[model samples]
Target: MAHPYVLLSAAVSLDGFLDDTGPERLLLSGPGDFDRVDEVRAGCDAILVGAGTLRTDNPRLLVNSAERRANRVAAGLPEYPLKVTVSASGNLDPDARFWHTGGAKTVYTTDRGAERLRGRLPGEVAVVALGPEVEWRAVLAHLGDVEGVRRLMVEGGGQVHTQLLRQGLADELQLAVAPLFVGEAEAPRMFGPGAYPPGRMRLLETRPVGDVVLMRYVPVAPGTGRLASAADRRWLAEACELAALCPPSRTAFSVGAVIVAADGTELARAYSREGGDPVVHAEEAALAKLDPADPRLAAATVYSSLEPCARRASRPAPCARLILEAGVRRVVTAWREPDTFVTAADGSGVLASEGVEVVVLPEYEERAKAPNAHLSPPPGRS
Candidate 1:
């Protein structure tokens, strides 16, 4: 059930319009921002757009820079990222530029729509059916498992962005703001109305790409949706296994921590006693090895065998404090910290209070506690 790390890319006007109500497509991004987007496209495994975008924009979605394409080829990737689109009815033009320009083309649609698209699409193009509806979750899972897509970039129309964000599937959002306003009510907007993730999306960075201002945001927490995906749970379990690699501790809890980027890459990992510092928490130890200025850290999630310590006697700042300082907004932990060393320690609560999304997968609790079973209190100790 592993899904691709989704990066939603879009351009909007100052007033939050994606396009104007005109016959010609409105250009929201400048040449500099366009090049920037092309670089992002080159780095990703696949580029996706809605069928509406394909019909309206007729975008080729190619890696425009020759050097970037060469770099991808040198890296053993295709000349361009795989082109993907989704439609409910499978009504699409077979001769669209997206079909001819990209290295590979895929269309995800309903079962009925698949039959209609199979004959219309090229022989090399793939048509996948996901039940009676085009589910975003299923599309991503198929892309990750079958298509081998790790980083998926979404160049969207409004509905596509809304669906991904509303479903809580998107990891990062790169929004480029143009310096104009399209005040037409009928104009397409960036995102449709939906119950989005709670709290303000964490702004990672802001840079000026020509007249356009590029802003990056991360979905630090889920609002009403499931917090952790199956892949996230697997990573958390791996972190727990890493804890077993640590030397047994009599005073400190044996714990492990891993920092995973939004793209599912393990950025850094550490267990207790990683640097021979018995007092250093696992999350702190792992974070210390990473550069503080790394922008990826903001979009990364920290996985720990146990909840980061809210208060600690061995160190001035606890693991919870350290994780917050490291700019990690999402944390998935196997078990809540027991009062084995510190009493009334509420690491999960501390993280939640600090606006960090904390997901507890109690299914892995036993595995996480196995390494430190000796530290657990006996029955009736409470």
Candidate 2:
């Protein structure tokens, strides 16, 4: 299922504390950093915080810049991003500033929580119940599918950030590191100890924002089994973009493939018709670049814009067989092969039958199909 691009945003002290254990909420971000956050909030479709943050900070979570709000409206977006919060117990205070100040509000909670919050919140506030337990995936799916939110910014209480990261759902992390230290041991921290996704996050950028340094990072580890991680989406999007580099194919579908190691290293990538080889498939070209006996191939994942070919006359061995021979056990693809060239082609089934984990994300189907649009039947035809 398609989910919003989840960006986890936070400001932490030098000692890795979110705030000091004081009577008042600790001010970690400088004025400049605060304005930067406002710009980010203005650009997003929604701003979310955990229930604990709402109660402790009592933040309105507004854009705070008139010009930025005007720009959002000018761009045909809501003046303020929708305010979102999660509470499994439905313990939110109706009079909190979070409820009274936002453009629109949504509460994601459990079934019992919904029962308690139904008539308590304002009539405009939407309360969505996600069955018995409030799962992070369910909240994200609802935000993307039902609310039409493409980009969501998560401003957190440590528990929420920890949950999202541990679940491999956070696409990006934007952390502002403050100079001062909150030495109190009982103070809140940015992340609690838990099993996070394996490997180091790819650092996107680092910059000085007043007294604080802002660092942006993206997760890179491919997800296990059939679950698609945010990193999986990033790699698949790259494959779709690579498809555009292929020589315009009339008889065959243009495709792209990437092989990534288990530790988030990209082993190889290639596009169809690369190096002027008319018969070379994307997966074949990428695999040819790596040694068959390479240790990484055993744990690597093959991401293709289109499904591997089940049958092809141009090549003696189809991509599916080549992948199996290469010792790859996991495959992520964007689109299933149409009947344009072969009838009843089932690369996915063939891979699955052999105990390979094949994951297809339909969200990228259109992108994978774009380069082959010319080969598709006309609008009125079958």
Candidate 3:
């Protein structure tokens, strides 16, 4: 299912605390950082906070700058971003400023919670139920498929940030680290004790905002089994971009492939027809760059803009067979093999038949096909 790009935004103390153990909510970010956050809110389609944040902060979660709101309206967006909240118990104060100040509001909760919140919240607030428990995946899918939300900003209260990161759903994380420390161990922290994605996150940028330091990071680990992670999408998108660099060929499809270890290390990347080899397949070329006995291949994943070929006349072994021979157990692809080059070629089927996990993200199919636009699309696809 398609999901909105989830950005986890937060401010933490130097010691990693979200707030002190006090009756009043702590202010970790300074004025400059607050303005930067407002700019981010104006660029997003919706702003989400956990029920804990709403109750503790009672924040309006609005674009505070009038000029930014005006610019959003000029761009055909709402004056203020939609306010969203998540609660499993449905216990909330209806008089909270979040209910009275946002342009639109939404609540994702359990069935029982939805029932309790239906008539309690303002009529304009839309309450959606996700079975007996509020699953993060379902909430994001609803936001993308139903609410038409593309960019989602999650300003959390601890538990929400922890859940999103642990579930491999968050695409980016923006953190503003304050210089002070909250010595209380019982105080709320930005993240709780839990299993998170393997390896360190990729740092995109770091800059100073007033006395605080703003840091941006993106996840990189591929997901396990059939569940696709945010990092999987990122690597697959890079593959699609790489496909555009392949030498234009009428006799072959332009494709790109990347081999990544389980710990988010990229082993190799290659595009089709690279290095003046007209018959070199993307997957084959990339695999050739690494040692066959490399231990990482056993747990690594191959990300391809187009599916590996099941049958090929150019080489003794097809790209799918090469991947199997290389000890790879997983493959993530954007587009299936089309009949433009080979008819009835089933690279995915061949991989699956050999006990390999194949994950196809159709959301990037258009991008994977962009370089091959002159060719006919798959029979059932545009």
Candidate 4:
């Protein structure tokens, strides 16, 4: 699937200073702007930065509201967003308060730098190397594949911002310009060294925060050419299509399965197994293929439109045991079983005691009723 698009956001002085040589810098955006930022960060899957910004900014980089944190938990987002830092020159402070100050932090370096720096300091965070050098393609692939980081927010230090913009990797931008100016020839500007051609910006929204003017934009499709990979976009579109196929009646039974990686990416489109067909079910089929030996699933979660079965003649084993054996951390099922052939009310507990998380989403039962109707057998045929 295509990875998430990038959103570049920054607070700069009228002269484009991300930060003065001092740490006591005040935010340019007022309360209104800060709230808007919270809304943006809440929806993001990850936050990114260059080594330079991490060292200079030393930011805590966390959503400030407890309300937001609770909402994130309710929605099944990671307790914290993934923090990613990219470095090429092998220069980084493993002990920099910036990393330890908040959530999980990961380092991206060249194959050469990964070891050299990792060997230099033993920190709680982990490191990922980007080939033998800092290759952008490799970085993006790793983020999308291994990390599953879509919807990335690239916060910056001048050079990093310049590179992504020049390379057309940035999809959207939010720039907050403080009314004040910090003019110095040596100071880095917002974009970076370029006699470069100018790009157009279409304002999405504007607000006066403190004495700052905040402007947001989505690149005119042709401008940055930062298109979402066809695969990634297709998954989202297909999901919507599947969602629309649910019985038109609002209270009708709806059953769906969602397979999500820790990175927030949907592994495979949710679907059914063989003749069982679409409305027949979706979640169970996705988990069926996961090999018991596959370690990539340690952090995966499966959301089903129906409760897991304690009995299934369709296979040698029931999904409840298979899910627990697969080490699935959480299982959310929408409707309970009405058919005697497949019952889990008792055996589901067996798996839960083994540490698997099982949740019954009775709320969606109506949508699942019709699909299981066929399993109910013809009129008096049982």
- The TM-scores, one per candidate, come to 0.68, 0.98, 0.98, 0.56
Model 4: residues with Cα > 4 Å off, grouped in runs: 21-27, 119-124, 195-199, 221-382
lDDT tens digits, residues 1-382, model 3?
7899999999999999999989988899999999999999999999999999999899999899999999999999999888999999999999999999969999999999988887898899999999999999999999999999999999997899999999999999999999999999899999999899998899999999999999999999888888899999999999999999999988999999999999899999999999999999999999999999999999999999999999998999999999999999999999999887789989999999999999999999999999998786568985
Off by over 4 Å in 3: 377-382
RMSD to the hidden true structure, all candidates: 10.1, 1.1, 1.9, 14.8
Q: Kindly provide the TM-score of model 4 when superposed on the true structure, using C-alpha atoms.
A: 0.56
Residue-by-residue lDDT tens digits, candidate 1, 1-382: 4577899999999999999989999998999999999999999999999999999999999999999999999999999999999998999999898988768889999998988887787889999999899878789989988999999999998899988887778888999999999999999999988776544666789999999999998764422223565446557878999999888789988898989777656688999987777777889889998998888888788999999999988879998988888888888888998777788999989989988888887868999999998886789995
Q: Please report, as a residue range, the 10-residue window in candidate 4 with the lowest summed lDDT.
A: 221-230
> Model 2, 1-382: lDDT tens per residue?
6799999999999999999988998888999999999999988999999999999999999999999999999999999999999999999999999989969999999999999998999999999999999999999999999999999999998999999998989999999999998899999999999899888889999999999999999999888899899999999999999999999978998999999998889999999999999989999999999999999998889999999999999989999999999999999999999988899999999999999999999999999999998997798998
Worst 10 residues of 1 by lDDT: 221-230
What 10-residue stretch in candidate 3 is worst by lDDT?
373-382
What shift in Å separates residue 225 of candidate 2 from its native position after superposition? 1.0
Query: For residues 1-382, what per-residue lDDT tens digits would candidate 4 score against the true structure?
Result: 2345688898888877876554465566678767767777777888888888777667767877778877988998876688888887668876676566557778888777786786664466778876767866566767777778878888876787777665546667789887877776666577877632143544688877766788887543111112322222223233333433454322222344556554445554354442335333344556655566766566665655556666655557666776777777665554565545443355446657777666553424445554545445578887
Q: Is candidate 1 or candidate 4 better by lDDT?
A: 1
- List where candidate 1 sits over 4 angstroms from the true fold: 223-253, 256-303, 306-382
TM-score winner, 2 or 4: 2
Ranking by TM-score: 2, 3, 1, 4
Please give the TM-score that candidate 3 achieves against the real structure. Answer: 0.98
